[model samples]
Target: MIQEKRSKRGALLGLAASILVLVLVIVLENTLAPTSQLFVVLKKGAVYSLVAVSMNLVNGFTGLFSLGQAGFMLLGAYTYAILTVPVSAKDTVYYLFGGSAVKFSLPDLFGGVDTPTGLILGVLLAIILGGCVAAFFAWLIGLPVLRLKSDYLAIATLGFAEIIRAIFQWQALGPITNGANMITQIPTFNNFNITDESGKVVFRLSAFFPMLIMIICVALIVMLINSSYGRAFKAIREDEIAAEAMGINLAKHKMLSFVISSFFSGVGGALFAMFANNAQAKVYTSTMTYEILLIVVIGGIGSISGSVLSTFLYVACSEWWLRGLDMGSFLGIKLGLFRNGFRMVVFSVVIMIVVLFFRQGIMGNKEITDLLKPRKKTKEVAK
Candidate 1:
């Protein structure tokens, strides 16, 4: 009873703290000097956090080692880009296709290109459609692919992603996908900007829009993980044969988890495209999926908080914040030893140290609250 009360209090505190942090970020993003590089990293990190959680839902919670996140992301990014790109911009964006096969734009269909409200709805719809398309593809792939176990499953999923990439790049699909060319001018989070009459910044759109989207995605995953179905997933993860013997339908549950994961990965991809200012099939490579998997591993499988935390760390250290490693200066001194790609070299070394020393990862399959408890009591609970 006492432990339960402590846990509840901890959760409440965490919630309050998260809200405070959200508000603080909003204020900083809008009122402070135009969105800083740090804010850019944070926004990107939020998107990554969402994808990592989705990946965790399958690979960590469900004990599926699927490696098709990049494929799903490609679907989402392309769907979003193709739909949200301005009709006026399509011919130019799809110059390679002579004229895009998709002559009608989603924004125009919804009155979005001409009006603010429609623009908002259309952008939101594009994001939703992106997820739906990815989920549909996941369903198709999951039908046969989900039957495989372990490494075979991983290979099959990875291959499916490659096939999807190839299809998107094919000439026959050139009209819709632009045939290996990048889809640009898609409505980004920046499109929702609210500015002053004098063009002075008021509420920054880019940071908050994507942040809100990511939060919603993360919330959905949490709800799913805590639901009764989550228990079935956990059971399957522990022992699939045992779970099946106990009346669980392994196929149904696996398919559901896979579809859900793919949906969010697609959404994340769309946000990533917006951040990157373009979507190209080449950008959604296997190497990118491996990076997300590395985050899940570093964060502790089955630990959502771990995934979220590690995402910020990974993005900050590896991409944006650690640029100093490549620069000549360090602190107050000029370091001549540091050179190009040093950030990645340092990132790899750090990952190796984490893998070797922190066997269970940063959070180690535990919630953030678990860290708040007495170490002895937490260890007791783990045992």
Candidate 2:
């Protein structure tokens, strides 16, 4: 009992430490770090963190191999972008085939409103709408595709993603999507402000705000995974046949996971669209989905904390350190080739090495709690 007690205490300590580290990082990014560089890295990391966590929900926790995250993300992205872009901005050369394609901005019911408030409302609406739409798709597809397993499931999801892309690519949907032509005039998050020439009400997308939101969502997922329902999910992942024999409703749980995962992915997608200030359907391809899968696998299947940590590290290394390198002045040498695809190549190689050496990934099948157990000391009697 003492040993068990120690183990629990150690787990709590580890969780506290991890939270502390995250807090410190956020603080540093806000106060000390370069604004543009820090925002870029954090924004991208937060987006992928959502994708990684959602993929882990289905693939890691539920033991399903899903490859349609990019498809779902694209749907969310387009939905949010379409709903939020200002009416005046839609009249430009960018929005050419404008009939009833754009929704008219409603008059403020509560007195007068400012630009910042309007932008914030738009963002909130986008996220909510994206999540609802994605959930609907999850339910629609879950009925038929959830019946398959392994490679068949992967193929089905891949095809579904392709179908979504093709639909957007179709000219029939041009009124809604602009179809292959890019959607522009997407107001950036930083564009909104009620400054008094003092830059006081800046409302910049602070590193802390986005990170806090991401962490909160991640924590909720972790809590769900550690609960009884989460254990049931693990049981299904380990052996579906045995889990069903034990009276667990397999189909119900599977659908639940899919819906929840897709909803979060949609939220993530909306966040991504807002950060980018533009949403292009062409970017939501199979390659994007595959990259997210790589993140989940390399971090460790069925590991939430692993995904979060890996995402930050991956983004920092890829976007901040490697891609942002001043190649011409690196050690005063003419090593300028390390500024472009070099970062990606190196990132890919690192992933390959991790797979080769640590196939189970950084966290393996264990949670952060499992790594912090206190060593058992051998009790000595009277010698």
Candidate 3:
């Protein structure tokens, strides 16, 4: 009963905190200019947070070192872009290929593209479709690759990603994939902003939209992590042979983790496309996977909150906070050594320092709520 009370209190505290954060985001969006640097950081951070957490689900929780996140994301992005692009813009977007093979757009089919309800339903459907596509591919790939252990699994998945990228860019598939070209004109987060008839902005929700999605997705992942299946995953991660000995289905849990991770990664990819206002196969490269891997590691492998915190920090440092380092001047100090790609160099060094010193990472498989708990003070009586 006491433990249950503590859990209930924690739940209430967490809910209160989440509501406060959402309120804060709404207030900031309305109070500040739409172009504020904070918005950029928040929007991108939210998207990356989802992907990072998805990757963490497999790598940290299930002990699967799959490196095909970019491939799944590419699938998701293309699925979303191909399905959401306005039919009128099809000729232009796929002009090089003569026209998109797909005739209908999701938004158009729902209730016409202009209706608010239709737009919401259409985008939601498209995102889910993207995830389903990714999960399907993950299942197909997992059949053989999941049998491999450790680095071999990683190599096979990485190869799969490269192959998928190549396939998506093949000229013969241009009608569907756009063949090395970008798919644009899809509805983006900016569309969520409320505007007057004359196009004057009334409320900005570009950041809030992604934040809301990220929170919901992350919450689902958290609940899964706290479930029986999640425990089975952790058991497999700790000792596969031992897990199997304990009556756990290694193959089943592993496949479930892989598919779920890919599903969310695909959703993240769709969100990424919305954030960028375009989707291109070339952009979802091995480098992207490595960047997300770095986030997972730097955040601590098994911690959901760690991934969220680290993603925001990583994005902000690379995109905004350390940007001056690339301009050859920071804090009024100008130096030739700081020019161009110097920011990344400094960022890389900082990452190394964190890794070497902290080792287990910022949270080390612990969530933010772990810190929220008060420690009991012990009294020492000396004679």
Highest lDDT scorer = 3
Model 3 lDDT tens row, 1-383: 97567656655555666666677889999998887788888889998999999999999999999999999999999999999999999999999999999999999898755678768899989998999999999999999999999999999999999999999989899998889999999999998888888888899887888888888888788878878999999999999999999999999999999999999999999999999999999999999999999898899999888898899989988888888899879989998899899998887887888778887898899777666655632121000
Global CA lDDT of candidate 1, please? 0.84
* Candidate with more favorable, higher lDDT: 1 or 2: 1
* Highest-TM-score candidate: 3
For model 2, residues 1-383, the per-residue Cα lDDT tens digits are 97567555744654566467566655565466345566677778888898789889989999988888988887888787777656666666245576437655321211112454565666666677887788789889999999899789888988888898888777777777877766665644444433566657433334554555566667667767767788888899999999999989999998888888888788777767767767787888899888888888888998776787677778778777665443433345556575656667778898999888888887777666555435633121100
Q: How would you encode candidate 1's per-residue C-alpha lDDT over 1-383 as one tens digit per residue? A: 98668756655655655666577668877767763676777778888988999999999999999999999999999999888888788889888878777777788788855467777788788888999999999999999999998999999999999999999999788888988788888877676677667766566766878877887788778768877799899999999999999999999999999999999999999888888889999988899999999898899889988898898888887666677788866555667766787778878887888889987888888887666644433221110
Lowest summed lDDT window (length 10), candidate 2: 105-114
Off by over 4 Å in 2: 1-30, 33-36, 105-117, 191-194, 197-203, 324-339, 373-383
TM-score of decoy 3 = 0.95
Give the C-alpha miss distance for residue 260 in model 2, angstroms. Answer: 1.0
Instruction: List lDDT for all candidates, in order.
Output: 0.84, 0.72, 0.88
* TM-scores for candidates 1 onward, in order: 0.92, 0.85, 0.95
